[model samples]
Target: MFGKSLKVFGILLLCISFTGCAKARYAAPEPETRVVGGASRAEAFRFTPSGDQAWLSWEQKPTDEEYGSFILKIGRANFADGSPLPLDTAVGVEVVLWMPAMGHGSNPVALEKIDIGTYRVSEVFFTMPGDWEIRVRRTTEAYGVEETALAIRI
Candidate 1:
């Protein structure tokens, strides 16, 4: 009886150890929203009128709808104190790219969907600007409408 009890205890210990290991190996995948906006989610580009042109780039996160729509709006502002201008008074602007059925909505340029969570390059031009705000309005099937804004100095 003693030997049988000892064997049962050892088996129980081994089962417990295996269960713990399995639990340790299991990890939930990071959410899509968190991954897309990793570091530059809210980051804005800064420019100083180099050669009368500046390159703008940003990341956009999409939902799991296979297809979605978004609107990109670029705003130009004349700042005196080096501060970012308000969203309401952004004038003298240009629409670099406008695409439909793509990840980004109406604009001047077309952005092709590269992968499930990535988008192609969308470029814009700033003509002698003091401050420019690059705004993206994304509409997903799951998350409705989301906005991402970036400010650049030129």
Candidate 2:
């Protein structure tokens, strides 16, 4: 009986140590930000049967004065309300397509100078019917970052 009790206690201590180690490994880190901005100017879009599209546009200001150039990073998520949902928790959330204007493009088609002020952007399209979220992350020349979120249903 004494030997059996000692073995059980040893097993319990090993399990507790392993649990602590696993918790440390599975911890999530916080996000890091360089320069902060007021809000991002983003637009959401959806297509009609005749190939027509809709857009929800907004205006934004630079986070810092050193912002010389800017590029928009767009991503899509599926939610009814435009709330920040975890990517892993959300269902049907996928990046349909993304376009980076200026230096934003991974494979830039062409470079064009955007007028420094409020401007109208091109219409984004949704291929099929579902909930979608469009997020835009703008990076400036001075390393300033700004982001905005928009939700859409098709």
Candidate 3:
């Protein structure tokens, strides 16, 4: 009877020691902009569609109107090798915000060009947010179309 009780206590002590090694920790989210991209990216921006390129940086523009509405800027576009794109390179950009779970998108987004390789995007409305994706696309005659997506929660 003493031997059986001693073996049981030894097993219980071993189980308690293992449990302490597997403690879980809570992590707080970062406030910086993060984008999901493939290996073919320049700096923090993700450029896609392969070959000849364009890019969208993961920098958020501050908005004055409301919390749901925001602004974005598309700039510093370059080649896959990090070389500057030509000054006359014709480019068209479009921004879309959508919730994939609900299968719906927000209002129209305005794309305004300030200068060559520089653009000001506004009117990004989040409506109601659970999880949202901001799809930024750039189209050109040379490279066809290249796009990058940023997933965010509001």
Candidate 4:
């Protein structure tokens, strides 16, 4: 009985010591958002700009029947300061790919509204290896229209 009591006391002391040595906790930094064309931005989308590819996972709202679509959750990351500005009040989004060096562009592709703000585009393939630009035009509720381009090289 005495041996059992000592073991229990030792365990209790060890647990108490661990509890007393608590480490400070720090919160993660909030993602940065900017107001552009009267819209709020969030790190709700992710893409590898260097690869000349884009994948967005926006908040799913009702799918736009006019623009039938699919979902591709690419994860989330904040957009770098300036360039490729994201609009909050975007009601319509379109993507176009152009190869400046080759002096040509891929076939026209339409982006379908899959979820609320989530959009999916088909046939965005780079046929040749060279400099490419993906231009995006967003129809905003307040600003009327906003455009940004993502440059990439292969």
lDDT of each: 0.37, 0.34, 0.57, 0.48
Candidate 4 TM-score, C-alpha based: 0.43
Clashing pairs in 4: 60-116, 61-116
Residue-wise C-alpha lDDT for candidate 4, range 27-142, written one tens digit per residue: 43322332222222322322322221224322332122222222332222335642233223456667776777778886676566655445676645556556666666665455
Per-residue lDDT tens digits for candidate 3, residues 1-154, read 9999999999999999998787456533322344332222332344444433334443343233442323334444454755545243446777788777799888877777766665556666677736777777777677677776666665
Model 1 lDDT at residue 60? 40
TM-score leader: 3
lDDT of 3 at 67: 27
lDDT of 1: 0.37
Selected candidate, larger lDDT, 1 vs 3? 3
Error of 3 at 83 (Å): 11
For model 4, the run of ten residues with the poorest summed lDDT: 61-70
Sort the predicted structures by TM-score, highest score first. 3, 4, 1, 2
What's the distance in Å from true for residue 96, model 1? 6.9
The true-versus-predicted C-alpha distance at residue 77 of model 4, in Å, is 7.9
Question: Which 10-residue window in model 1 sums to the lowest lDDT?
Answer: 46-55
The candidate that achieves the highest lDDT relative to the unseen native structure: 3
Per-residue lDDT of candidate 1, residues 57-121 (tens digit): 34443333322223322223335643233232221233332222233432244455443333354
Query: What TM-score do all the candidates reach, one by one?
Result: 0.31, 0.27, 0.51, 0.43
